[model samples]
Target: MKDYVIGLYEKAMPNTLTWREKLECARFFKYDFLEMSIDETDEKLKRLDMTKEERKALVDLMFEVGVPIRTMCLSGHRKFPLGSEDKTTRERSLKIMEKAIDLACDLGIRIIQLAGYDVYYENGNEKTREFFLENLKKSVDLASKKGIILAFETMETNFMNTVGKAMEYVKKIDSPYLGVYPDCGNITNASKSLGEDVIFDLKKGHGKIFALHLKETVRGKFREIPFGTGHVDFNEIIKTSYEMGVRRFVTEFWYTGEGDYKEGIKFSKDFIDRKFEEALKDK
Candidate 1:
């Protein structure tokens, strides 16, 4: 049977919770791993006033609770302008990424998701592309030193918005540490294609996929729609991923502040379990 690792994005919580509360929420969800996006201005981290020892103690507590951090989803790109023409902004972004890399290394996490180049702007010319490549090379070099695998995620607006483009970028990088984290929901709006098409393209690019993000989209808006209520074909996606040798799959269900967190986790777990069982019987 395929081993399914269930997780949740830290951003799913309302920013009102303390660090202890966050831990309680993770326990409530009963997740196998915790995926967090650390922000520089996060008040919770500030309120904790945690030293390195304190942080380690907290990590130890999580381990004792049976939910270790499997991935660190760095939010560096939001504050620092990566892949931008602005020199100062670019430098700042790299600095933030460097800090994130160090934190991941110290925390013993292996997977660091990069924001890639911002796609909100339409001026992604050759210069911008080269900048991204150069910065990515630097990031990968650092990750390689720390024995970390850096996974670049595709956004709606970036140099690599599709699986093909993401694969192309990863191939150009030509490093074992550099790969793609395929998001099932992001590419749903590119055309009028079905979710199966997204899975097909991702399968084609599976050689470069290091991790998987399970999300769903409706029409053009991407959200945390419960599995099977949206367009993503979970069964085929999971089966193809398993065949391609992807061992880590992260479920991203953004909390909409309406329902119980336990219910969301159970619903997602049931969907994943059902799909894995189906895939196994078919195999």
Candidate 2:
């Protein structure tokens, strides 16, 4: 039997929870893994500084609860995107990537999802694209050395808003450890921006897709919307992607404590599972 590793993104949990509590939440929700977040908050960012012993203890709890944090979403790039034309910013982001690899090694995480934008805070150009590729090469080199994979996410940017653009860097880097972590919702939004219709075929990136961010997004909206409330064509996207090569998936969403969290988790789990089943049936 084939296994589909469905994980819950860290956004599903309250940031206030201790690592152990977070693991427990994953176990309670029947998820196979937890996609850890290393976002912009000072508290979240501090995880990069975790000591070896602390990391081991956390890993121990992961084993205890049967919820491994197998993937990481590296969101710090919002502050220090690697593709920036500024040398200082690019250097700082490169250092952050190095530290992130070390942290991943300690925690037994396998893949780090890289943000697509080389410089999200600024506009893009050929120079910025060159800088991003250069900096991404450095990151890929480090990740290869550390025995971890770095999958780039297609984001809301002109540079790499689709899997095809992400493939540009993946092909340039051409490392076994470098792959694409596509966000189908973001792809829809990008298609709208370009006045195109699904320019990126997930199958085109087959063998290079490490995983997926299964978030819902309407054409005009991007983040924090309820699941299935957006224009994300879950049935088609899931079917096509599963038929390609992706078996790992993380449902990307933010928890604002507006409604019942447990109920919502169960609902999403069921919905995704149903979609996966439908995808398999179509095969």
Candidate 3:
């Protein structure tokens, strides 16, 4: 059977709580791993309020609770373009990524997903593409030194928004540590762009996928609906991923609403378990 891991995004917790309370909630949720977002204001290692020893103690507490960090989702390109000609933002993005890579190394995580260049349209010049590849090579080199995989994720508005384009970019990188984190919902959106079936895109892109983000999006915006409530076919995704030899998955459902977070996680766990069992039965 495949190993399914539950994780909590930083946005899932109440913002008013302290860092200790957030970590405690992750333990209470019984998650096998935790995922954190890396942005300008959310650097995990640069918390001014927590001393070095206190952060180490928190890390120890997480290990004691049997939960390890899986990845740091770097949100560098949401505001600053990694492929931009702007020197200041580009350098700042790389510095932030380097810091995140170091922190992930300290925490023993092997993967860091880069939310790639945030291009508004598909019309990317050769210079822009070259810049992207060069910057990524730099990031990949830094990550490789730390024994970490720098996985790049697709975005709605970018050069590599589709699975085919994402594959092309990764193939150019040609590093074992360089791959794609195939977001199911993103695939669904990109299908419309090509006027093709979503599952077809997923199958074609499965070989290069390093990790899977289980997302259930409704309409254009990602509302984090329950597993079966959205158009993302969980069964097909899981079956295809297993066929591709992908085992680790991160369940992400972030929304501001009336539902209880714990209950949502429980439902997600049960839903994934059933999907895996069904896949095995078919096999």
The most accurate candidate by TM-score is: 2
Give RMSD (Å) of candidate 1 vs. truth: 3.0
lDDT of 1 at 30: 62
The per-model lDDT (C-alpha) reads: 0.70, 0.85, 0.69
Distance (Å) between predicted and true CA of 259, model 2?
A: 2.3
CA-RMSD of model 2: 1.6
lDDT of 1 at 112: 82
What local lDDT does model 1 show for residue 37? 72
lDDT of 3 by residue, 83-122 (tens): 7676886786677767777777776777787775633323
TM-score (all chains, Cα) for each model: 0.87, 0.95, 0.86
lDDT of 2 by residue, 1-283 (tens): 5477889998886767788887888888788999999986777778899888899899899989889999999989888888888889888889889989999998999999998887877887889888888888889999999999999898887778898889888999999999999988898898777776653556668889989999888877878877778887787887777777678999988788778677778888888888778768846
Clashing residue pairs in candidate 3 are none
lDDT (Cα, tens digit) per residue for candidate 1, span 132-184: 77887887888888888888776666456567777787888899998888776
Query: What ranges in model 3 sit over 4 Å off?
Result: 1-4, 18-30, 40-55, 118-125, 257-259
As a whole number from 0 to 100, the lDDT of residue 37 in candidate 3 is 65
Worst 10 residues of 2 by lDDT: 195-204
TM-score of 1: 0.87
Greater-lDDT candidate between 1 and 2: 2
